[model samples]
Target: MGKATGFLEYERQGGVLVQEKQRIKNYNEFHEYLSEEEQQIQASRCMNCGVPFCQFGMEIMGMASGCPLHNLIPEWNDLIYKGNWELAYNRLKKTNSFPEFTSRVCPALCEAACTCGLNGDSVSVRENEHAIIEKAYKEGFAKVNIPNIKTGKKIAIIGSGPAGLAAADQLNQRGHSVTVFERDDRPGGLLMYGIPNMKLEKDIIYRKIDIMKEEGVEFKLSQNIGKDKKASEILKEFDSVILACGAKNPRDIKAAGRDAKGIYFAVDFLTSSTKALLKVRQKDKKTDNLAKADGFIDSKGKKVIVIGGGDTGNDCVATCIRHGAKSVTQLEMMPKAPEKRAQDNPWPQWPKVCKTDYGQEEAKAVFGSDPRVYQTTVKEFIKNEKGELKAVKCVNLEFSKDEKTGKNLMKEVAGSEKILDCDLLLIAAGFLGSEEYVAKAFGVELDEKTNVSTQKGRYATNVKKVFTAGDMHRGQSLVVWAILEGRECARQVDEYLMGYTNLSPQ
Candidate 1:
């Protein structure tokens, strides 16, 4: 703790953003970093609770209630408060390998479980993290930590996402030679493609990867193990293999006209858009595979309907708006949450409520109306003569608990069916599990949901010398969880490879 009266003296202050109107014009990061003085003021607000539930990382009511990485939140907050940024950066790096990525994109579970949040606001832990890590970069403190001795063990990590990266970082620190294989053209799997550039700039990812490269981690891009590259070769070559392939198989909508040409998976759309942006930046004149001017699905001058109102759906809305669509609408099956926390929702758990995300704000600003349609769903698709999706047939729903089963379900109101004119339809229904090719190729067992089946707390697969982590084992989750899984999984791999390990979870 920096000062006993620090919490009382300062209130929480989050990072600011660029104007919504200006930010929507291009695919770039919009968040403005807090000034050094402002970051210190926010850091001083940490109460440094005795219990410190923020780092507990427990499962409360079947949901993650705190930082899964169990980050040293209070220590870093105190460090920031005292203007000891290098120390704060060191503490952050002890557990998390990529604070810059998490600081920008993570949901900040630590703040939700903050002790100060019991009565009032929580400390800006996420913003303070962003400040510390960026400060490290500026002050030349962030660099490659080359191990003094080599263990002569070799490890292969399948997938270059957060989990794989973290595992590589720790395992390499143990003096084992590690190589990461990614099917995509670049490293940073989902971070490089699945997420939009505006949320996380690609250069930031490349910068860290450059350092990792210098630290002796080899990255092989466009190498699809078990497909283009043989799993047998990998198994024969490396002493151990860790599968960190993220959950990429998207959950799709299977309604009438689902095979129509205009419909697309949210991941596909986002991935294509990012690829287009990267191509443009690379100045590759090859427009052969670029997303059309009408948007990923040609939303320009056409009505766009997005299904499933999560972060992916919001991204579609923002992307369409930027593409100059005539109109954009989103559908949500669940009822709209309240604006504030309800009486039943006590402190230290995620606030169950409605909050306008950045995309929605941009939509509202441009369209002069909130584009979300809660308690509604697309029943079917209406197609044109060319077999392209022209509109979506939707129905209003009433959410209520069933008397017989006592389960919440949606009931369609009579004569509530309506057709909304649309040209592009995006299904943002989330992901089921990791892709089947690599897992099946490696002969790894899977859970009922198709996730890599390893007992919780143990990341080892059935095959000896094989390990798994991130969405490959846990399904879709936050980046912080991926980092945690990666770090912990690295420890497990180190122990298996050398019969001993020194990687600390804390």
Candidate 2:
């Protein structure tokens, strides 16, 4: 809770974002923070409501309403309001293992469900968290905590993603020797590459990884389990194993010329961009010179089309803009959401409203119009004689609810098809599930959605002494949920290993 009258007296203030026009020139984090005093005032706006829904992580109307990690928003906000910077950081770290990652990338579910938002602007809980975490790093409070007593138990985590890293951190703190195996050369699965550098710099991830290493968590890079290393070997080496490899099998666009050379998955494009950017940074090359990089899918001076209207698609738009795209267009299957909250979509539930992400903003700033075209999808990918992508045949669609099952059905609008010139096509249509090879290698069962199958409300799989969590277990989800799953899974593994656990699941 915050000051009794603070909500009425203060207004919420957010971190200042660099103008899109200037930020698109390079791939770097563009958010500028507020001073300590200003952030405290914003934190003071957290009302002392009897029912603090901001911390109540729950699913309502088939969508997440609040912070899935159940972060101690009120406690941290109160501490920040009182200028107890260190204590605020402590309280924040108690629940959220990595506030730095979430503060920069998370959509701020806590703010959306804040009680203050009922009548006025929500409390700047996300900004307060950012301030606390950054201050913790600056003041050296974010130090490594090597466990005093090392348990004989050893855990082999199969991924270095948020879930895997969180599980490793918790289990390591509980004195279990933890080793995280990553297929990629670098750690931080999605954080490392899938997300672009502008949203989250690579150095931020490496900074936390260094601290984890100091805390006694081992990271084995370039170790692709089930391929390079057998799963049986890991099971024999470690007392227990947890699979946190994220859902990475991207869903493909079904259209003619799908095999065109210029088409790429959104993750692949983003990964390449980040990898090239990091390489250039290491060589002291100009940051904006990613087009000259050898490995990346260069979008400079090329007409680009991105399919899918989600966060990843927006990221592709922004990345293409940063690459100095000749033109950019985004297609969405669903109709455009209302600008503001709908009457049926009440507070305390995830608001189903239109969100103009940073990438879309940058596209508009550069192109003089929003790149998104709602109710549209690619009907065909037209390739030239050279077998490279040349254009896309797109069509508008309409949706209607069925009478019996109450399910929405989509139908193409007659005579709405149109052709647009496109040199590059990026499909950000989301993922199907975890890759099959990993599941088969581990001898784990998969559900209909291709996610690792488990009993209802359980992290344990069919295999004995083996567990799964995060997107690999629950399908595609947020980083916060992945961390929460990892923490909870670590607790389960700890109990199974030691017959009891003192670790907190929350």
Candidate 3:
């Protein structure tokens, strides 16, 4: 440990953000990087316990408790505290290929299981992580990693999200020619579109992609493997294929008037808004009619109703508020978690506490209150004469134990139905599984949950010379988990190609 009494002396200093009033004006990253001194103090707060639960990476109470990537949290934090920038970055990259992505997007599962959090606030593990990677970039240590030799082998990776990108980075470093195919015009997959610009700027992703390209990874954009290009052709061309297409089959809200216009999936809405936002920026166009453009949905001067109270729903709330929506509301099926961790939620398990996120914070600031309506759901959709969504029929829910199964069930209150004005309805209810075409095209089997099937604890699919990873195999998960899956999958692919392999394991 850098300082024995560091945890006692220093309070957690989280990353600061731009004021809501200022940040709401534009779609750009708002989190202000902490200074070197402050970051050091945060890093020094790590207890560096005998067993660092922060990096334990185990399932506790059916939820992720530690860093899924098994990040070397204490090592890097100590390095940061001691000002060993290069060593800290090296240790970080050894376990994670994309700290930049995880630093911004990962829920910081490490922080939740921190030893410090057992009694006091968690050490600023996530913010310190963000600091290390950003500082590495500033110090020019984030350079291209070119292979010293060529293996004369080729790998084709489907989907250019975090998983595919990590696999490509690893395999390319192992002297294999790696090629990533992306269905969208941009290559970062969900990282480029599904997530908003304010949280993770697109340019950061582009810069990383550019570095990968320079390091000999070939990116094929707008190339849908199952449709635009034949899977048979890809199989014939490469020695191996890794599918990381992600779980994109969005769950629908099957309520009354569900087919009404102005109804969109959360990903679709986010993707369209981002695409339009960038297009306007690139064209240097000056207009407030962003949503008025064809195929774009704007929330300006409208009452926006978002279903499902997860990160996606919160993102929708923030986006709508930025769009100048007259008012915004979010509906969650489950009751709100307590302000503090419940007794059942012991240490090392994900707290499941009611913590306000950036989006909710912004919504609270702008709308004068939190927009989340807990234990609520949309019962039906109210449509106008033109078949456009105008309002949502909502109802309150109560959790009760089933008499037969002893399981908790959501029982709708008999007289709690109410109608709320809604100009646009975005389904943020999460995803079911991966889309069907690619799996069917490649003849890969899917599990009961609709995810690509692989042997228990393995990344290789039943199909010969094919593999699956990330959300495609594990269902929807954190960015850190995706990176872990990709890295492990690459190792498996490498071992299959050569009789053995030399890849790092977390």
Candidate 4:
């Protein structure tokens, strides 16, 4: 720790953001970085507990309690507090390949499990991390680390998302030749498309990819293994293949008129929006087929209905507001959570409660009302004469314990059907699993939930030289988990390829 009495001297100071009214007018990041002095003070707040549960990465009640990548939180926080930013950045890079992405989007499990949080506020670990890495980049401290010797082993990483990228980073550091294949036009998979540009700027991803390229990692874009190129062919050329394809199979709504026009998956909408933004940025005059599809589903002058209440749903609301939507509403099947932690939830656990995210704040600023509706679900779609969705029929629900199963079950309230006028509908109902095409082609077994089946510790599949990581192996999760799985999976692949490995998790 920087100062013995730092926690007592300084209270927690979170990162500041632009006002909602000003931020909603454009699709750009509005979060302001804390000054260097302020960041140092925040770093000083780390009490550096004896056990340091913030870096333990244990599973409490099936949910991750700390940094899954096992970041050296105390060491880095102490480093930052002492004005040793370069050392802190190096410590962060030891485990995570992409701190910029996680710093921006991750939910910050470390703060939730902080020992200081038991009595007072937790340290601003995430913000301190963001400051350290960003400063390293600006001061030319972050550079490509090229291995001195080559192992003569070749590895193919399928999907260029966080998991694949982390695996490639580790394996390449071990002197293994690594090539990543992505079906999309660019690398970074979901980071490039699924997430909105406002949350994570595409240039940040490209900058990291450029450094990785300089480090001798090859990225093949628009190459679909098992489709454009055969999976068997890749297996023959490379000594080992790792499938890092993320969970892309969206969980769809199957109500009446589900196939009607104007209704789309949240991923599809977000992807289109990002593509449009990219095209505009590059000044591409040639219109693509998607660009020709009534011009990218702009919410301008339209009433929007989002069919979920998770982060993705909230993102949809924010995007719609930016596009100048007339109105916006988000539906949640589960009842609203309590405003504060419940009695069952104790110290050192992730608190489950209701909180307004950035998107809801934007919606409230523009429309003068909160956009979420709790304990509600869409039952059917009302279509116009042209077979386009015009509105959604929905109903309220009540939750009660079932006598037989002793589980909470939802019961729709009788005579509670209602219709809301809507011109655009976005289904943000989450993902099922990784896409089936590559898994099926490789003959990989899948769990009941459609995730690739593999033992937790042993990430290898039934196939001898095949491995899996990220959402492909563990299903939808945080970027931090993806990075951890990727790093561990790369160590496994290294040992399998050479019969020994020196890649360190420390």
Model with the higher lDDT, candidate 1 or 2: 2
Could you give the candidate ranking by lDDT, starting with the highest? 2, 3, 4, 1
In terms of lDDT, the poorest run of 10 residues in model 3 is: 285-294
Which is better, 1 or 3, measured by lDDT? Answer: 3
Where model 3 places Cα greater than 4 Å from the true spot, the runs are 285-294
Question: All models: lDDT?
Answer: 0.87, 0.91, 0.90, 0.89
TM-score of each: 0.96, 0.99, 0.97, 0.97
lDDT per residue as tens, model 2, 379-494: 89999999999999999999999999999999999999999999999999999999989889889999999999988878898999999999999999888999999999999999
Pick by lDDT: which candidate is best? 2
The residue pairs found clashing in candidate 4 are: none
Candidate with maximal TM-score: 2
Residue lDDT tens for model 1, 203-291: 99999999999999999999999999999899999999999999998988878888887888888888878877777667654432335
Kindly list the per-residue Cα lDDT of model 4 for residues 1-506, writing each as its tens digit. 77789999999997779999988766677889889999999999887889998888888877778888889999999999999989999898887789999998888899889998888898888888899889999998888778898999999999999999999999998999999999999999889888887789898999999999999999999999989999989989999999999999999989998878899899898888888777766764343223334467677778999988988998899888877789999999999989977888876778787979999998888889999999999999999999998999999999999999989999999999999999899999999998899999898999998899998687999988999999999999888888888999998999998898899863
Runs in model 4 with CA error above 4 Å? Answer: 284-294
On the 0 to 100 scale, the lDDT of residue 56 in model 1 is 77
- List of clashing residue pairs for candidate 1: 294-298, 294-299
Residue 303, candidate 2: alpha-carbon lDDT = 98
